[model samples]
Target: MLNKIKKQGFLNRISSLIIVQVIFVFAALFLIIFNYSTEGSVSKQINEVGKYQTISNEISGYLEDNISSLTTDNLRYEYIEGELASYDEILKAEILTTDKDNKLTPIFSYINSVQSVTNEIPQTYIESIAEHMISEFNKSNLKSQFAPIIYNTNNIINLLPLKNNQKTEAVLVIVSNHDFIISNRSELSYAIFLLFLIATLFSLLTVYLIFNRFKWPLNKLIYGFKKTARGELYELMEPEGDVELRALTSAFNEMSKTLWENSTQLKKSNDELEESNYLLSESRSYFKTLIEQSPDSIVVTNFSGNITFYNDKAGKLFGYKKDEIIEQHIDKFFTQPVMNTINNTDNELNGVELLAKTLDEELIPVYCIASSIEDDKSNDIAFLFIIRDISESKDFQEMMIRVDRYYTRGEMAGDIAHEINNYLAVLSGNLELMPLFMKKGQNEKIVSKLELMRKTVDNIARFANGLMDPNQDEAVFEEADINQLIENVLAFLKPQNRFDGVQINTDLSTDLPLVEFDISQLQQLIINLVYNSAEAMQQIEKEKVINIYTQPGNEGDGTVRVIICDNGPGVQSDKKEILFKKRFTTKRKGHGIGLVTCQKIIEVHSGDIGYEYDEGAKFFFDIPLKQKSKEKISEEEKASTVYGN
Candidate 1:
């Protein structure tokens, strides 16, 4: 072969080279087409497999529905059998159950057969389904579940786990003939193979004829290129071929002659373009990293409300990957109210509360603002939304309100009972002394106690009426003498509920001026604080004592100072900061709002309330002694508090 080629002319050698080149090119082409056709055949087989799986999915879904809605236990069995009959590909179907006695029972064709000893295959299939399906279903965050498919030679079988109304474990067995689907696809494969063969033969023939036409001209061009590679500038092609080849030869000669002239300019432009591309790629990567690492969840959406981009926080907030969430509707994460806010306006942002739904459909409270983005636009109007989770804030707010309500109710009950008991105490004490008064016909002590009791009853009626109508003001602020209010509270609460086992002692200063404060709130505040002290002391077996004191303005703010001292364990130093905070508890079952209520009531009356531990628990309050007019207090028909303690 080598001696014959050496003796051949340039045109003959070129013809032989063309034949060999055509064969190599056709061989590669044929190989590519053969691989493509093989892929197509495998794709058809995949479709066939999918068809069988689809029927199984349909049957499983039907069984699930029937199990949920059917009345009788056997109704679902009958319906499933009917569905199985319709699918010719499905060869047979049956239901299996594990009885309470660890026995396996086969329900064949709508009839439950005798219970048999535990069959390992059915239980194994159920466990396998549970093992694989649970993880796969959880990854998708989907509810529908099925076991991994069991493939046979020409058929498929699956034992799907199902639970009935009573949560009884059961398995549904389905057998399908996959060979039928494969047989239907075989004809398509043969036809594709035949077409492929015929096309390969025709393509090779056409390519051979086309190559013969360009063989001699291509040889001349190859010789010219070899000359140029060797730095032979005087070299040129004959330019005597076809129009296109002759034109290409002439252009090649001209390009070679001025190669160095334009090469520098071309290389400079190419270098700059490549550098610009590299810089642009780097900037894009930096921007993507910055977004992915952001703390706050940021989502960018197009005018059509599809997700264009989202940060890592956004993916975590939505329980999805960046790839999974892209092109998804923005409304999927937004609740109805948030949707209304964004869709209502054309281009406006309002910092509003919204609920975001995660992949598992859990709703989270979020504060988000959506505003239009001005950029290299691909849509009519794009939006950038910055979202922050506010679930903890909302939870804290709800807890505070609940604790406040509990303390408020306790205060109202305690104050009302204290006033009502004042009357009861007078009646019980005087009843024993009434025998002497009735025999002697004297009425000093009796008259004084009866008057005090009458006043207590009147106050109770006023308090009850105020509570009935919530809009009515319960406590009136006036120039209240501290000494007088202290005496009145003592008289009214002598037989208190929380102070039953406790002895109260008081030291009063008569020189203390009148302070502007609400009577009922002041009474409630004192009762709650005193009750708190008594309850704390109840745990100890000591003689419980509470001492009350009133003094002239002593805080340098011209405010009347009052103190309630108790012989009980004082609050811990570390825990004192939370004493005035709602929901902070120290006792085993305490609401921790009594001190908070005292703080609120003192603030309302323009006073300061605090706690300290010197000998024991010491509650102190300071109220301004500025006197105010009592015109409104006088106009009310309620009687002045008359008491003897």
Candidate 2:
């Protein structure tokens, strides 16, 4: 029990309370015992004094009664003296004596030295009383003689004088023992001490039991509180001992209940937070996957235009690997100093821009958007760029321009045909009349002139027939033999001396797969590129060669490649980026729509077109041999097939 209390830190407090209570009870008991002993002693003394007074009064009455029986003075004296003779026998006195006439005459001086109560009287008390009585008697003025008296062997003492007929006859004396006077007081004191000891023991036992009862509950309450502070769950304490402790236990139980509820709530909140974080991480991973797999070039950079991230498409489009571009400044990739233009002003360029060039000098028409991103700390961290390559869209626009030009030229050719037919008919009629009216010698000269006129008419008629055929239509896309297409295109452009002056070479692969394309558009594309190559090489004094090659590309997808290369002053590295842009021409007479139109036709057939300037200018385009089915058919394709059939 002691060890347990010490472990609980309650031993000191319990001991202190017990000690204090014990001290209080002991003090009260001590005071009660002291007061009882003192009061009893005083009371016993008063009772003893009352008993002695009563006995003394009784003795005086006896003397008075017996002395009255004497008729004369001598007889009274004689009677008193006779009474003193047996005073020790009557009163059990220790001493008795009688005197007469101031003389030391003992009428009845029975000292009874052997039977005297000298043991009962204190010697000092007897001596002092004897001296006092003797002095008083010596000074008395009574006619009787004075005498000293002591009784009970000096414990009690008194003096008496007897008289007869107005003369003092004799004096009587008695003494008491002091030992017998205080015997009762000693017994009373011993009894009081025993009672005090009993009371003190009872008080200590009661205090110990009460302190133990209170300490048990208080210690449990303290221990429970300490555990709660350490975040350990503890059971509610039950009521014990007194009413006050029970009430405190009830309140503590309620507090424990509230704490348990709060702990459960906190755990639930923590779980929810952890789940949300997990979901957020998954979402981020999904978004990253989408960005990496997209077909368009995507780049992310800091606010200062330093590249931070790029996807696979971005690497291919810019001809730079991801490792090369990452962490590089955007300015390193652009061939020209990108002008910051906004509202026709060159100053503000901090936002999104559309068209841009790449490190490989390829013109990438992009739909670019840029926005600033901030980190959790609210610091301006980076810029996010979403770029979509719009090169195919630009090519489509150029195709529309060519189609419009063709429509206009076809309309003008019809009017020219009608005018030319009328003039020819009139000229023919006049020629017939001249032949009938001419002499022989003049006939040959007129004939010669007539032949030249016939030749001019024939050429005009052929030109009109070519324009009036009305066979031109929108190019149709289908699988075609590439080698056959190339031969047909070369034959068509062979009429122009432009092809004859250029050293032309062909390396057509025999096993090249037939690719899906528009044959008419493909022919036009070849014509445009060959014409451009011939023009570029016209000024070069060296052997100017134009090489056209066809081969199966290494792309496992069975697509055929067509390559056109020229050994002329190759396209200027600086100008290569915008070469195919609409109206971007380097020549004075150049319309700038030729290469753009070629790019458009290739794209319409689900193919790609690109240029390179290593060693010499080279233009290549790849068309997939197999057609890919669209998920949905368009209204235009349906209408065209219906009309044509």
Candidate 3:
């Protein structure tokens, strides 16, 4: 039964249940009303006979009250029957004896022959009397009633017992028409019918409203599910419903979107895989070369530190042939820890570094890792060591140390400059007072020499102040024309010391935009770089030339790019990684802060700098068209404190 109903839609099933509930409730109420009407009708009629009972008691009291007159029993009986007959409601009255005969004698009666159910019974005024219908009432089953009896819909009769001083037992029986229950039942039937109509209407409206509230959200979710099953994408309207329905809706929408995205990605991957299949053999060859041509040499040594097997890269790194180093102790190329780490079973080794001796007797740095495997002999094992050279990494570490030293030096220079400035300021004030105090100050010789001395002091002060001011964070950005800026810097550099002999070339792009930069700091960077290039070229007899190039950045990205290349011997392989590092210079008298300062200046502008060695060494950088934000820091920012004696 449940399965069959489940096949139906939600509205149909719910409506069926609600309808059955309403009908069942109405039927139960109707049965209860019918039971009450059947029994209550008879009991209600019996209680209504209290009016006639009161009349019988009043006549007995009257007989007692007037008995003091010494009236005979005949007089009493006549007065009782005639006085009771005047009442309008009394249909008939009789005195009865409960002897073995159970006899009854009619006294007086006034019955309403008109038999009107809706009219009021005449209790105050007199009612028209007719022959009492005793034969019909006696023939019916109402004779078995012990008290008042209700016959059909309009008839009422009562039996009352009475006593007299003569020791006689008599009963009063009265019959009348009082039919409130039957008439009330008719009106009540109409009220019951109206109540049923209202209840049914309310039940139907409630079912409809509840069903629609559930139906719309359910229908939307069902439609969404169906669309997803068909591999079609659809947008879900924002739900304003119960929590459970919204959760179901959201889950379905998310599932559909995820599946669609997965399908698209899967198709994209398939296409890419198919197209790239043509290069499979090429890729395999490339991967093979990658292993063979690896920069890190592969070497395996036994537990005795003897060379067993190595790739070609190992030979290149150690400067020895495989045969030459076959039985040679690995200690020839590795330090003591290599032997200790390889033999220690408790050691964890993966690329542990050691100092190695090359064929030329050079102490080169190398990283080594070794593992062991058990041999055929019990408790015997062999070790394999993989060694790679890390000379560049060592060079970078040393360069950073030197950079730290530079910061220390700059800090000292600033302090010394500050002291010198104080002295120079006092001297300037003293010198001005000198001319005023001289007696013959206007003499040509004195004036010319004093003026020369003053100029000399001024120049010294400028140099001292310049040293005190490092380009740490005094950022003053302004628009710069790249094409013109490079040219002017080169022209100014052409006459500086050794650079006077070097040729300079420029490949400036005319279409480049004006970029914002710190002018004074960038000028210092250009001068230091060009001068360093010239100093390097002075040693070599080759034609020394410096080439400078400027262009718009790649993809018109609103940046200015610059390249400075030198035709001297390119950077050596050992120093390639640390070429632009701080405080690692080739010049004998160099402070080693030229390239470092250049990097710092570029960083302040939010740019990048790098160097590469090809036919010659080339340094390049790209700066944004405008400084991100201009903020200045003092020279103390770039320096650390120094300990004094």
Candidate 4:
């Protein structure tokens, strides 16, 4: 029973209590109604009897006041019939006289309404009621102030004695039936019962409406709390109800909002912390691998030039054990001037030629690059030195550097001559046609030819000056819009005869963020790729279409990808692997330095380039939004002493 009660809902419990109370209240009310109904019915019956008594008294008074009328039976009969027939409750009216030998005689009689014609009431009932009323009348002691006597049976009878000068006389009697009294009591009982039934139905409907008012909002709050428990936090709706219930809902909404805000802030903090830790661990692992696995001797020292870290290569290069190298002054390995130069300068020392000493006091030629490693606050924490022994290969490296530089300059000059000769051919042809147009008196054609020749000459001069400049070798990194660069290259190239029949299509993503690159190198890269594609399609029969696309890199990698493809015969499969190598080209007059230079330019920017054959030659590259920290120097730069690394 207790379990069942506990399982019941709140509304069910409230309804049960209210229903029990209602039943008790209505039961008491029903009793009161029943008592009131009974009293009302009794009062009505009394009123009915009183009306009959009034009729009986009036008949007796009339007979007594007119003694002459009582002396004749005719006069008495006339009076009783005419005056007493009007009362409906009075079933019958009669005057009876007692003669000698005590026998009763009916002097005058009249029956009222239904009973006069019907025998529904037995004749004995009326006779018995009349006798009882007369006995009550005769037993009265005060005859002058005589009152009527009432005898009640299935009908009521009233008796009033008629007297003259203190002598016994006829008695006036009235009979009334019980029809109106019985029916009225029954109707009152039914009305009371019907009223009770209506009250009960109305009470039940009120309970239902009240229960729903509380149940709906409580149910919504319960569902909201359940969701919160499952980590899906949300606010609850404020509903209309009792004040206490509304207050509870308001409190829940406030608490939920607070909890959600705190949870979101905590989650964000955790994510940022985790990302920081991961980057730190990755950075540590990366530096550790580069220092330990690097072919050059890596040495780390404090700002005071005291060695703090020595790798395996460093120990072998200096001919010392690991214990012998720790805490040693860098001047013990290199000359004092080397330490002085590194400490006094703010810039990195790249490929600084110096003599390094061994444990046995012998000196050897070595190339060293030194830089300061700083903390997050930009405070210098340590100095890093990468030293490569050049004892055996110094002369060979110098020769190779000269050969490489000469070859590169020769290739650049060849490419320049090829580009210039194409423009010069256009200039020569226009110069040859200028006189003919002038002789024909076509000034418009002549002016157009002259303009073309002038533009071509100006383009050659600008191109030669930019390409021949020595400072162009060093890349200038800046924030550049990639799509704008492609557009600029296309604008410059489309006016040239090499791309006259070529259709160039560009699909650049508008939302691409700025990428850190060398603008001049990027423009040169585009021009070279476009020129290569145009040359590859010189003999293709199909429409020469080149597609250039720029878009963001893979999601969250913080890079951008660029693609340039042409509908031309792609490179031979056997030659694809060597496509970016120096002096490797299939063009009849090509020096093949363009693709190699493109590769080097991208490499210096810490980006990767690739080529693939997809219906044609497709060249693509991925460049980061920001360049990574330089971990090592390139072989070419390491060949001899170089500065400003």
Candidate 5:
């Protein structure tokens, strides 16, 4: 069916439209000519009626003038006879008068020839005509006074009134025989129809001429185009048509010639391409081996994120056989968040740490790198993913974090011990004093000693709680006051000997809203930033001053901004860019994870942090008042933080 439809020529399609148009035009012309002929006949009949009306009016005027005369016995017959003789078409004429009883009587009648006539008018018409005669006596309303002209083909009857002094005295009835002639109307109509018929024929002939003029050439061109499409490259002869069609044929022939030449050259190129293909086949094997033996897993996917190819390392990493993994969507093996990232990535992804699930449903941390493989058109045809199982590396990172935390704790160990010893001393003193007071029967002193001892124990517990390792804590988000957290951090740090001469200024906003964050991570972030500042200031001979400021962020943003500025030598311009990168540190003993950890903490909270230099080194960060909903963040990902390179 499709082939049959395709075989239909363009002329066939257009011929239907041409036929419809011609039929419509012919119908319109027929209607116009027919209506004109009809109207002409109607107009001719109306003119005859008007002529009859004039004759009736003359008869009514004559009767009105001589009505008084015609009623007299001396001139009645003579006047009626003479008037009726003037109108040769009037078959009958009567002057009707009403008697005292309102009965109609013809005073005078003239018969031109013997013919049937109706004197029986409707009673209502008689009364209506009488009234109209009085109204139209001097107003040129002659039609109103005349009875409606009764026409039977060419026969007509006219009833008019003869009035005297604005009063209808009598009615004049006339029956006439006249043949209305509309000359040459049928001939004119026939002529019009004949002309239109000739026009239609000429139009169709022109259409046929135009169609034939182009049809043969176009069909030949279409054949050539089909041949070219099938690689036959048939040449077309210049067709006899208009300039455009001839030019099209010439161009087609030239194209066919060029293609034939190109075909010859293409054969040689194909031979070279075959040789190149052999080399490419060898290269493909080499790359395949390299990819298989590569330590990192390699997976290739199409635009749909479905796995198209994967090396043995990838199979091993995911615990999937070739049959199990091939053609599966990335989400089948990757965690949802990782799948989302992969789908959203357009060009390239580098060093993204994500979780992947193995065939046994065990999730392991992995580092991923991906890039789009595009063709010459820069369209992404496939995607290449380099996957590395980072489970062992993640374990090592956690260990290193523990070691870093332990080292930090070791640095604060003296302060913790000093705080504990002070509380212990107070308790010991209270214990001895309480015994002494009890022996002396001093109840108030004994109660005071017990209260003091309770307070000292509480202090010791609070200090110990502050010293707890953040690495061992679960990642739990909660609303906390910025000023309160800062005060707690300062309380622990100020009591330490490392800050003996260092002055830390605080300008925290009193009305700051509580922001959601992981408490342990926040504490760790503040500790790292503050310790780095203090340690940076150690080399400066000037007074070491660190200023911390907190304020509400821009309205409607639901964030609070905190700036920690220190009067130490700010970071060098050259090294500032990498200040927060992994393993980048400005401190001699710094592990470089401090700022990087701080950045990661802020990121997990959906916040932003940056550094700027004015008169001093200023580190500013914005924390959202609320964290992202828990459902969007998985427990494992939230619980883990990448701290090192």
Candidate 6:
């Protein structure tokens, strides 16, 4: 049954058994060797200490025995008086001496002195005993030795006197060789060497047995793990070694099997994800291409109004290149007033908006939609702007508005003219009747009344004629000398009732070029400007003047400039840009269309009208010279022939 269980590979029975036996053998051998070695060393040290103590006690006993033989009260008095001088002879006769010429010969003299019965013993005996005592001292041998005593060397012994009262006592000394202690140490050292050899041999055997039992199984498991990590399920790991190690290996093998199975499924999922990403990228590219090829202007911007992308149409509309406009703020394209409104609104200007003017001063209206674009993380990354330029549409609408205004004004003027004319005709008819009905005496009052009525009718007819003249028809372009035109305009306005209190100054440049313009319209434009100047200067009490000038401009462009300036209050700073817009009047009773009509007339002639508000209001217009063509001359001749008829 045990063999069957071991073959089943559930646990590494042989490896566990070998490991346990190896550990038990190594530990038991190590402990036994260590205990024996320690005990031997301690026993050696104790034996050496005991030998030293015995040597010390034996030396003390020898000294006491010798000193007891020498000390006597009568002998001490004789030694002090230097009587019985042969101390060596007396010591030799009283005691057994080992060597007669030994280093302790002086100790015999001291003993002889203490043994004397006479009042004196010789100083030679005392000196000899003292010399022997010192020769036997332990320090005598140590003083001559440079190394500690080994088994071959003699153990040194020292004798020292114990003084009692005034008497000098003798001391004995002994010396023994340490050969016996050395022999015992050698035996103990041999035993320790043998035990160490056995332990080393046992440890090597145990390691060999354990390695032989487990090395094959561990290598197989490692190889299996590496193959599993590489996605190669080549083989299943076979359990080896103890039960715990077999269980661990089984778990690891199962985990690797599961991982290998999941890896295949994961690869399929990754393939799908990659395909989705590719399709998304392709879709983005297609949309981008479509936007780039679009004819209508398209721009994408951030919430801060910074343009992120723009199409070619956008570049043309804004008069900027794609690279130049991208990353630039949208506010950079707006005029000051519009920019202020946009900034104040926090870039959320809604409804169909118009830019009013492009970079090149061309009127461009844009209908735009602004929407926020967020990322997958739901973060507001940017804004998308889609715009359409409506300049042509706006121009058509403006034309329609102007035509409407004209028809409405014309109708009102016609009605007023008709009523005034009827009243004038009635007054004229009454004036004629008054002349017929009056007698000579009543004729004075009737004639005076008729004269007053005729004057009122004449004034009424003049007012109606002025009102009936169509200013729009007079704005047709014709070839005329600009200098003569300006002088005529000033002359016409100088005598007007409105100019009574305003001083006029004229400086017309000679040799001016001819321009194609409507003479009546130019005159009206000048009249309006002068009238505005007069009104502006109404508050001035002194030196209220209007200066009119004409000059040739640079570039030999055949250009003529008409300037009308006044020493009047200048245009308000904030209203300067809108001064020519329809219905944007600053006066209570004045229609703002006067300056707007002037601008329109100048625009139709392919000229420009501008103003400088610094140091009072200065209005100016410049017209380019118009060259006559052969076709125009032919048309003029045909008209002349018909008129001649």
**Leading candidate by TM-score:** 2
List, residue by residue over 381-450, the lDDT tens digit for candidate 2.
7766666766566444554435534642443454455556655776777577676647555777677767
**lDDT measured at residue 206 in model 1 versus the true structure, 0 to 100:** 47
Q: Is candidate 1 or candidate 5 better by lDDT?
A: 5
| Location of the lowest summed lDDT over 10 successive residues in candidate 4 | 396-405
Q: Per lDDT, what order, best first? A: 5, 4, 1, 3, 2, 6
Cα lDDT tens digits, model 4, 1-645, are 887445655456566757765775676576665566457656765775466556555666666656555676577667668776666656676677677754467777776656642335455655565555556656666553333333433565555567655544666665555543343445655666666766676567667646675767778878878888999876666655544456678888898998899889988999998999999999988988888889899998997888999998888888888788789888889754566887668836877778788886656668899999899999988898999987446352333333433454454565556677889899989888888898899999998888888899887765643442233455567887888778766755665667779999999999998888877667666777887899999999889999999999999999899999998998889888876643366689875667766776677677889999999999998888986534344454565456545
Q: What is the C-alpha lDDT of each candidate?
A: 0.64, 0.61, 0.62, 0.71, 0.72, 0.58
TM-score of each: 0.36, 0.43, 0.30, 0.30, 0.41, 0.40
Error of model 5, residue 198, in angstroms: 99
Model 3 C-alpha lDDT versus the unseen true structure: 0.62
lDDT of 3 by residue, 87-111 (tens): 6666655554444564344443434
> What is the Cα-based TM-score of model 2?
0.43
1 versus 6: better TM-score goes to: 6
Put down candidate 5 lDDT per residue, 1-645, tens digits, no spaces.
Answer: 888446534455457556766775676577665666556666855665586556556655565564554565536457557766777777776667667776566777777755544344454554455445434543664443555354454556666666665556677666676555333557656766776776677577657756775777778788889888998964656655555677788888999989988987898899899999999999998888899999999989888888999889988888999888889987787776454675576567877877788886766668889888899998988888898877456354454445556767877888778877888899988887876798899998888889888888877765654564545734578888878888777877777778878999999899987788877667777877788888878888889999999999989999999889899888889878776653467766766666766666676677998898877788988988988776756554555645322
lDDT of 6: 0.58
Off by over 4 Å in 3: 1-298, 311-324, 332-532, 539-551, 554-559, 565-645
Return the number of clashes found in candidate 5.
0
Prediction RMSDs, each to the true structure: 49.5, 15.2, 31.9, 29.6, 32.5, 19.9
Best by lDDT: 5
